[model samples]
Target chain A: MIELQHVSFERQGRPILVDVDFEIDRGEFAFLVGPTGSGKSTILRLVIFDVRPTHGVVFVGEYDSQSIRESDIPHLRRRVGVVFQDFKLLRDRTVYENVALALEVTGAKRSGVKRKTLSILSAVDLVHKRDVYPDTLSGGERQRVAIARALVNDPFVLLADEPTANLDPETTDQVMKIFAEVNARGTAVIMATHDLRLVERYGRRILRLDDGRIREDMGLVKQV
Target chain B: MGLLLAFREAFRGFWRTGMVGLISIATIGASLLVLGIFGQVVAGGYALIDRLQERVEVDIYLRDNVHRRRALVLARDIEALPGIAEVNYIDQKAAAQEFQDMFGAGMLRALSQNPLPESLRVRMTPGSDLPQRLQAVSDVANSNKDVESVDVGETWVGALERFVQVITGIGLLLGSVLCLACGFAVSNTAKLMVLAQREAIEIMRLVGATGSTVKLTFLVGGAMQGCAGGFLASMGQSYASDWWTSRVPDLALDPTIDLNFWLVVLGTVLGVVGSWASLNRVLSAVSIK
Candidate 1:
């Protein structure tokens, strides 16, 4: 579960996000739809403690983002799985190595990392391409590898930012289906995307943002 | 289990960026090498001073026209002094013979008369108060007005001690500067290596890798480098000592080169500490990313 209350982030005398309040409860799939520069990714960064909120509190599990010590950020991050639009895999490593890295950093034994990596890769339908490097993979496959990596730790909440931005329509549908499956398995998923069509098709809880205000619509919300 | 896992991650990291690891090790080694060489020089200087000290003796010359029996009696009295380790009375005839052997028999024949005075050669104990002992003996001999000079190489000893002190002061300053420079270089190199692994590090941080775990990887990498450098330096020092000592036949003239336990230990500590310093800056600046 993730919660943000009256959170405002500013840098260098300019505002990035203003008084944003949102929560993703346990086992609930949520959508964050916003225009460019609307602070969607900033919100995700705040939840993960990558960047601190200037004016409000952000909580992941029990961690208080605004007041958390520098050392506690890593612990907080371990409990939350994050999928980036860039598919930030180590280019030199294989898909399996990228996924195993999550467990590896947690000080998992080699046997354990291997077991968890293979299972997670299979979950994302990337079992066969486990040994393949990121550069050799297609955009869809790379995103799948990233998903596998995010899921390797079996985090309670998954935050995805434009995961399907570079994927084809068919690949986008596949990736969305994977999110649906992950959500169905009781892992809460909060995705930030501009694709209103996917929102209508999936019909999940939607939180739209325009001019730094939360506009919640259950279904078919019109974008300004 | 924890240690094993840490090492596994370290090796895995080493494999991922083998080149970076090698460069870090090489930097650590080179820094330690410089430290080792300076240490050996100081050690060698001390040994040379010690050898010279063992062979050292002060000559006490008796006044001319003094009775031979009186001079013999004076020698016995001074030889009984508290600080005297050994006393050899080189009588006039013995002194003349020593001069002949040193400068050759033809040189002594060229002189019309033997001008060398009968002298008492004194060797002092290791912890003897050289100035006080020399003064005490000189006073007793001069009291009889039968002593010409009491030579302890007074000015020369003072100069040697001062030279040793200056060398020690300079060694400390240079060693400290070398260590600081090595630390800066190692940290900069580590920073670049961290940059190379920026994404991998982010993922590690996200997955709950403790700050210590990441830090230890770099530290261990640095330690390995230091040890390697130390070993290479030690080997080089061994060869140099052998080659140099073989060339210098007189142990008294040759400097002392020591590879003592504590010196090696100091060099090792410098290498490790330098690495630690570099890693601290590197991990702090890059951990957030």
Candidate 2:
């Protein structure tokens, strides 16, 4: 579960996210629809505890952003998966290694890393591409690897930031289907995106952001 | 397994950095060699000074016209003295033998008479080389009727020891400053190599890796550099010392001085501390989100 209560973030002299409040419960998929600079990424950052709220509290499960110690931030991160439009995959590593890195960070044993990484890669339809490096993979494949990496540790919540921005339409749909399946499997998903069609096609719960304010918290007619 | 991964990562880093890693190791080894040699020279100087100090003792010359029986009795008294550790009596014939040994048979054959005097070479107690003790021992020998004069050289070894202390202090200070400077320069260059590559450390921290876990990789890398550099430097030191010893046979050097182990220890400290400094500076500024 993630909550942002009356959170306001300012960078330099400009306001980013002003007096924002929202909550997405466990096993729910929420789309964060917003224009550029509407603070979608900042919300994800707050969830990841990269930056504390200037005036309000952001909560990720039991961790309070304002009160979490630096030493405990890594533990908090272990329970959440984050994906980016850029893929954020280590280019030199093979798909399996990149995914295994997720498990490795948490001090997982070798056998567990192998098993979990392979299982997650298979779930994302990337099992065949396990031995290939990210630079050699297609955009969609790279994005899938990122997703597999994010999911390898079985994070309770997933935060995706425009994961399909640089992806082709067909790949975008494939990526969306992966998210849909992940959400169906009981992992909460909060995706920030500029794609309105995804919001319409997926028809899940949507939070529309305009000028740092949440304009709409609309629930879809049929949830995936 | 965690340690294995850390070491693998470290080796991967070393390989990825290419010439930077080689240059770092080379520079580290060169500086360590200098430090090792400096240590050896300082230690050698101290040993030489100690040997010379140990040789300092009082010498009592017997009256030239005095009876040999009285001289033998005075020698026994000097031996019984509290501070007198050993007494070597030089009778007229033994004194002439020493002169002959020094001057050679041909040179001594030119002399009309034996010029060497009967004397007692008095070595004081092992640690009783204090000026007061030396003077007291000399005074006891001087008061003897059979003794003409006693020579203690006014405890000049004390001044030599004080001088050696100053030199040792300077050597330590200079060595420390030089080692620190070299370590800083090399670590900075190594830090650049680390940052020049993809920021793997940031990624490592992003995915739930603890700070110590992330640093473990870098620490292992630095330690490897240190050990390798230490080995190279020790080899260089051995070669240089050997070359110098061959050229300057008069200079006494301790072949058994095991500075290799110490060099490795020093190299380890330099590597770990340098990498720690660089990693802390870089890692602290990065946001782990």
Candidate 3:
């Protein structure tokens, strides 16, 4: 579960998030819809304890922004998977190595890392491209690899910031299906995007952010 | 698993930064090579000084009226002194014979009577303070009524001691400055290597990688580069020393195996320290929180 209570973030005295408040229970998929510079990324950053709120507190599982030590940030990250718009994969490594790295950083056993990485790669339908480098992959494939790397650790929540922003409509649908499958298996997902059409198509709960404030929160819509 | 991952990442980084890695290693190697050469020069200079010190002996010439028995007693008394290692009584006949051997029998045949005085050839201990201790021994020998004069080679021995002191002082000061410069060079090169991989490091931190794990990766990489530099420097020093000795046999530099081993170890330490310093500055600037 994750919660941000009356959180406000400022950079160089400029307000990024103005007294924002939100809570998401476990196993839920929600869309954080906002245009560029609307503080969607900052919200996710706060959840991962990458940056502390200028005022108020954020709670992700047992970690509190106000109380968590600097050394415990890595442990908090292991439980919260993240995917970026640019698909931040190490270009020098193969797809398999990129995914395995998530587990390796956690000091996972070799056997567990290999087995889990292969399983995640298979889930994302990227097992066949496991040995290829990211530079050679299609935009959709690169995003899928990033997703697999994020999910390989079986994190309770996945934070995706415009994960399909660079993909074509067809590739976007394919990547959305992967998120749907992951959520179906009981992992909460908070996906940030500026695309309103994509939010309507998914028919999921929406938290529309505008100019550093949460303008509206539409409860979950039943799929047609 | 942590250690293995560190090693793997370190080697991967070392390979990934190809040209930068090579430059770092080369910088360290060149610095160490200069240091190694200087070390050998100092070692050789000390060796030569030691050889010169070994030949230092006091010649106490006895008067013409002094009997052989009395000269033998003087030799026994000088041998009992603190710094004296050995004292041999060279009687007038033996001194005459030695002079003949040096100038040939013809020079001694021209002399109607032997004029060489009986002397006590006194040798000091190896580590006894030169010039000062030699002066003390001369004073003690001169006090004997039968002795006419004492020759302790005071001027040359004092000059030799001063030379050793000057060389040692200069060697230490220059060696320290050179070592600090080399450390700075290696550290800056390592900083560049780390900066080149800055994005990768941020991603690692963004993931679940602990600070220590990330540091270990760089530390291991730096140490490997340093070790390679050390090996190169050792080889370079040996070859250069051999070439030098071939041209100038008097300055033969024979650095022991122990010295080479320590050079390699010093290289490794420098690499670790450089990496640590770079990591501290870069890691602080690029904080995740």
Candidate 4:
């Protein structure tokens, strides 16, 4: 479970997220919809412990995010899967190595990591492109590789930042389907997106942000 | 696992920055070689000084027309002194023969009579009090009217001792300064190489990698450069020493100094420390978010 209580963030003397509060329970799928500069990425970063809140407390499961020691950050990170909009993948590495890196950094044994990495790659339908480098992969394949990397560690909660931003409609649907399957399998999913149509089709809880404030928190209707 | 990843990353980095790696190793090797050679010279100089100091003894020349029995009695007394280890009485005839052997066979024969005095050569204990004990011996010998002069290589020994002290002081100062410079240079070179591959570092950190893991990779790379450089430098120094020894023929140099082992240790330690220094600086600048 993730909890954010009156969380605020600042960047270089400018306020970014102003007293924001949100929560996602275990196995609950939710949407974080906001404009380009509405602090959606900041929220995800706070959850992942990459950035600290300026004036609020954060709790991911049982650990206090802001006050936890630096040594414990890696353990906290392992419990959450994060997908960046740019799909940050190592250009020189093959798709398999890029995904395997996530496991390797955590001190996973080689054989076990290889087995788990291959399984995750298969799940994202990227097993066929496992040997291909990021430069040669298409945009959809790159995003899928990023998703597979995130899921490789079997994190309890998945946080995606604009996962389908550059994809075509069909590929966007496919990526969403992957998210839907992951959420259906009992892993809580919090995705930040600008696509209203996809939210309507997925029909889950939606939290909308505007100018560093949460404008809407509502359940979705059936997309008939 | 951490070590393997570090190795893999370091190896990749070394290969990627091909010429830079080679240049770093070459520079490190040359610096270590210079250091190793200086160490050998300083040690050799110290050994030479030790040998000369050990050979120094007090020489008591007997006065002319003094009875040999009275001089023998004085030599016995000198030998019985606390610091004196042994005393050999060189008779006038033996002294003349020694002079002839040293200068040439005819040099002593040219003198109509044996002018050299019978003397007592007194060897001292290994670590006997030098100036005070020498003064004591001189005092004891001077009291006897039969003794004419006491030679302890006065001015020459004093100058040689002072020179040894000066050389040792300068060597320590120079060695410290060179070591500091080597550490700084190696760190800066590693920093530049890290700057080139910073993006890879960021990606690794972004995905739950610890700072130590990243640092270890750079440290390993630096260490490898150090060890390789040290070995090469040691070989070069060994060859140079060997060639010099061959040409000079009589110059004493210990070939079993284990220079290679020492060079490798120095290179490896410097490499690890330098890489750690540079990596810490670079890691501090990165933001995971």
Best by DockQ: 3
Q: Write the per-residue lDDT of candidate 1 for residues A26-122, one digit (tens) a residue.
A: 9988888888777788888888888888898998888887579988877777778989889888898899988887887777788988999999999
Each candidate structure's TM-score, on Cα atoms with residue i matched to residue i, is 0.81, 0.89, 0.93, 0.88
- CA-lDDT, candidates in order: 0.74, 0.81, 0.85, 0.82
Tell me chain A's TM-score in each of the predictions.
0.95, 0.97, 0.98, 0.96
Of the true contacts between chains A and B, what fraction does model 4 have? 0.62
In model 1, what are the clashing residue pairs, if there are any?
B44-B256
- How do the residues B48-71 of candidate 4 rate in per-residue lDDT, one tens digit apiece? 555555666899998898887998
The residue-by-residue lDDT of candidate 4 on A84-127, one tens digit each, is: 88998888789999999999988999999999999999999989
DockQ result, candidate 3: 0.71
What would the per-residue lDDT of candidate 2 be over residues A123-196, giving only the tens digit for each residue? 98889989988999999999999898888877899999999999988999999999989998999999999888
- Compare candidates 3 and 4 on TM-score and give the better one: 3
Best-matching candidate per TM-score: 3
Query: How much TM-score does chain B earn in each model?
Result: 0.74, 0.80, 0.90, 0.81
Q: Evaluated on chain B only, what is the TM-score of candidate 2? A: 0.80
- Sorting all predicted structures by DockQ, with the top scorer first, yields 3, 4, 2, 1
Q: For residue A49, what is the lDDT in candidate 4?
A: 81
Candidate 4 regions with alpha-carbon error over 4 angstroms = A220-224, B65-86, B103-113, B123-144, B154-158, B247-259
Q: After superposition, how far is residue A66 of candidate 2 from its true place, in Å?
A: 2.5
Better of 1 and 3 by TM-score: 3
Model 4 misses residue B36 by how many Å?
2.7
After superposition on all C-alphas, the RMSD of every candidate to the true structure, in Å, is 4.7, 3.2, 2.3, 3.1
Model 1 stretches astray by more than 4 angstroms: A217-224, B1-35, B61-84, B88-119, B126-161, B224-243, B249-289
lDDT tens digits by residue: candidate 1, B1-289 = 4465555555565565667666655655565566655666665666656555566577889878778788778878888887777878887889999998898888778889888898888776533245577677778766867788877754555556567667777778887887676566555544655566666667777667778777766655445545555566666666666676788756423344445343345545654576577666666666332
Two-chain complex of model 1, DockQ on C-alpha atoms against the true structure: 0.42
